[model samples]
Target: MIEIVRTSDLVLLGFLQSLLENANIPFFVADLHMSALEGMIGAFPRRVLVPADHVTQARRLIDEAGLKAELLS
Candidate 1:
C-alpha cells in the first residue's frame, strides 16, 4: 500500500475519505489508533493509503478536492 495523505485530524480525514469513496476509489486507513493516541498528545494523526497503482489517482482525487495532499516520503 502507498500512503497518500497523513494528518492527525480524523474529521478532515473522514471528509476526505468520503470524497474518495464517493468517487469509487479504494483506500485503506492506517495508524487509526494514532488519532486517539495523539489526541492525548494534542495531535491525532491518521493515514490514507491505496494500492500502488491507485496512488496517482488517489492523489489526484485529493488534489482535485482542493485539499492539500501530504505525500508520504
Candidate 2:
C-alpha cells in the first residue's frame, strides 16, 4: 500500500474516508491506534493508505475533492 494522506484532523480524515468509500477505493488508515499511546494529543498523525495500484486514482479523487493540499507528495 502507498500512503496518500497523513493528518491530525479527524474531520478531514472522515471526509477523506467518505470520499474513498464513495468512490469504491480500498484504503487503510494507519497509526490510528497511536492516539492511545499519545494520549490523544495528536502527536502522531493518521495515514491514509491505498494499494499501490490505486494510488493514482485515490490521489486524483482527493485532488478533485479540493483536498490536494492534504495529499502527501
Candidate 3:
C-alpha cells in the first residue's frame, strides 16, 4: 500500500474516503483505531492508503479536490 495522506481532520478523512469509494478505488485508513485509542487529540494523524497500483489515480483525485496540502505524496 502507498500512504497517500495523513491528517488529524476526521471530516476530511471521511470526505476522502467517500470520494475514493465513489470512484471505486480501494483504500485503507491506517492508525484509526490507534488514534481513537489516543483519544482523538490530534496526536496521531490517520493515514489514507491505497494499493500501489492505484496511488497515482488516488493522488490525482485528492489533488483535484483542492486537498493537495493533505496529501503526503
Candidate 4:
C-alpha cells in the first residue's frame, strides 16, 4: 500500500481515522502504539498511515474539516 500521509499524535491520528472511516475510505495506521509511547516517553511526533487510494479524498476531507489539515481553498 502506498503511504499517503504521516502524522504524530494518536488523538489527531484517531481523528483522521474517524474522518476516513466516516468517508467510507479504507485505511490503516502504523506506528500508532509506538509513536504514542514515544510521544509520552520521548515527546516525539507520532505517525499514522493511509492507503494511497484514499489519500486524495482523505486529504480533501481533512482540509475541509480544518481539524488538522489547514489548507487554503
Task: Give per-residue CA lDDT, model 2, range 1-73, as digits (tens).
Answer: 9999999998999999999999999999999899999999999999999999999999999999988999999
Q: Model 4: how far is 28 from its true place, Å?
A: 0.9
Highest TM-score among the candidates is held by which one? 2
lDDT tens digits, residue span 1-73, model 3: 9899988899999999999999999999998898657876888988999999999999999999999988884
TM-score: model 3 vs. ground truth: 0.92
Model 2: pairs clashing at backbone N, Cα or C within 3 Å: none
Runs of candidate 4 exceeding 4 Å displacement: 35-39, 42-44, 67-73
Candidate 4 has a TM-score of 0.64
> Could you tell me the lDDT of residue 72 within candidate 4?
20
Estimated TM-score per prediction?
0.78, 0.96, 0.92, 0.64
Candidates in order have lDDT scores of 0.77, 0.95, 0.91, 0.63
The CA lDDT at 23 in model 1 is 82
**What would the per-residue lDDT of candidate 1 be over residues 1-73, giving only the tens digit for each residue?**
8878887766788897898899888888887776455555636567788998887887777777777545665
Of 1 and 3, the candidate ahead on lDDT is 3
* Cα lDDT, model 2, residue 10: 89
Find the candidate with the highest lDDT and give its number.
Answer: 2
Cα deviation of 68 in candidate 2 (Å)? 0.6
Model 1: C-alpha RMSD to truth? 2.2
